[model samples]
Target: MNAPIRSDATPRLEDYPYRLSDNVRFADLDPNGHVNNAVYASYFETGRVTLMKDPSKGLVPDGLAWIMVRLDTHFRAELHWPGTIELGLGVVKFGRTSVTFDQVVFSQGRCVASAQAVTVLIDETTRKPVPLTDEVKANLKPWIRRGLDLYQRD
Candidate 1:
């Protein structure tokens, strides 16, 4: 387990310049008739992958991989099927070898679920934590948010 270094604050989705939209599938619903809680993580993944996987973005290198270390999710509201949702993600904190992402799921402009995840970059072959290079930082610079902690709960 890696130690988390709390920054001055977390950032919001709107604070970032980019986001991804995905739809809830009929099969995603649980017996309770709403999107299962488990699906929220996948939605978060979609947004993160979209940003990180693009070589043009330079967020992640070709031979490097990111692994999730921790995730804190708050299920504020339920999401129904037959609907579209937007996932917005931003950098909460940038560590020596890890980046914490704050993300929210919105349905019809209403926040349904939000999460904060800590991910570490590792060398694909060695599978060891690697420091974020200057190039990676340059790519991620556009996504960093400095103030207004979205993860703070009432």
Candidate 2:
């Protein structure tokens, strides 16, 4: 008989940026009785924030916000009703003032949804794109996929 794949050998989505919790609520479902596609954005956003900056010991308060420049969501399967979810996030590209985030939602252990977004960091006052801090680079370096910065940054 063939042996089952070990958990350690499994391609862990959490290894890159890490996984976050997502518990579906009644409101999460639409009239169609499944989680709304739009709500996937929120799930991804929360996961990205937590991965880039820890909640308790977070990033410097330089008065900055990450504004989405683009977003793409792909639904692999339908998830209806209340259930626990896991959101895995990873940094694809890090730029002067922007970062590409790839997010995936797993129902139980299978990927049910996926999303990608580019968020440009900006000064809260000027709302203009700014350079990335070394601190942020050090924090997110491990999570970023290799060659993600081959493209230009806006």
Candidate 3:
């Protein structure tokens, strides 16, 4: 049996970290009645924090700051008002002081936009990049999926 393909052709939870769903609000819509291009940033940021701040796993360090070093987004189609949107987040790379996240946003089971970001672990006070600790890595491991298990085919 094959898993259903998502609208944006992204991998499933087996290939990703966590998935979150949201609804477009009156405040989120532009005069055109569709979500604005910039709205995706806030949507992406929402899932980013949740994935790292899971209280059970607690990836966010007490004295550390996980700051965004880079962000890139791709829009597959325009998303309009008053609908359900799903966000998929995964770690594609983990470094000594940073991690790369692949975040995909979907509506009605189709990907409307996606983004990739590089986040650096930093000293909360000084805001400087620091070495990633094993404790943080340990909590993050369960969320890491090898290769492209999200893909339906080899």
Candidate 4:
């Protein structure tokens, strides 16, 4: 999938509709004293999972489950331990059987990493991709990325 066209301008945390805070753990550090690159994926996952798994969100329908099909990450800055990080996620695209999300990790007001993840809805029994239901689409509308024209994108 083509990544979104990012402007030279920096991204603001508030641009994302869904936001959460997490701590940078000592175990997340690498030999260079920066957060391990692999750990950023977990932080991004926490943002997406927290939003989709919330009962109030109504994202996952009965008898259905979401599975990650793709994740593209961009590491922006070095992050140190003993600090709190902010995570943000916003729905960027809705396909017939998949949802694409734009995610970010911020520390001390600076963006540390960003990613795009694609997840497809699947039948719990068959484990096959399923088209998104109207209810699920409606529930996701409010979570779209701010300043984006959802209809204009491919």
Index of the highest-TM-score prediction: 4
TM-score on alpha carbons, each prediction? 0.85, 0.77, 0.82, 0.93
Ranking by TM-score: 4, 1, 3, 2
**On TM-score, who's better, 2 or 4?**
4
Candidate 2's displacement at residue 20, Å, is 1.3
Off by over 4 Å in 2: 1-15, 52-61, 145-154
**lDDT accuracy of residue 74 in candidate 1:** 84
Ten-residue region with minimum lDDT total, candidate 4? 1-10
- Order of models, best lDDT first: 4, 1, 3, 2
| lDDT per residue as tens, model 2, 1-154 | 1112222222346544567777988898989999999888888888877765664434434687667888887788898777998888767666667767767888878778877778887888998888877776666656654334423433
Candidate 4: residue 153 Cα off by (Å): 6.1
On lDDT, the leading prediction is 4
Supply the TM-score for candidate 2. Answer: 0.77
Which sections of candidate 3 miss by over 4 Å? 1-14, 145-154
125: Cα error in model 2, Å: 1.5
RMSD of 4: 2.1
* Least well predicted 10-residue stretch by lDDT in candidate 3: 1-10
Cα lDDT of model 4 by residue, 1-154, tens digit: 2236574457789989999999999999999999999999999999999999999999999999999999998888899989999999988888989999989999999998998899999999999999999899889988888887675656
Residue 78 lDDT, candidate 4, scale 0-100: 94
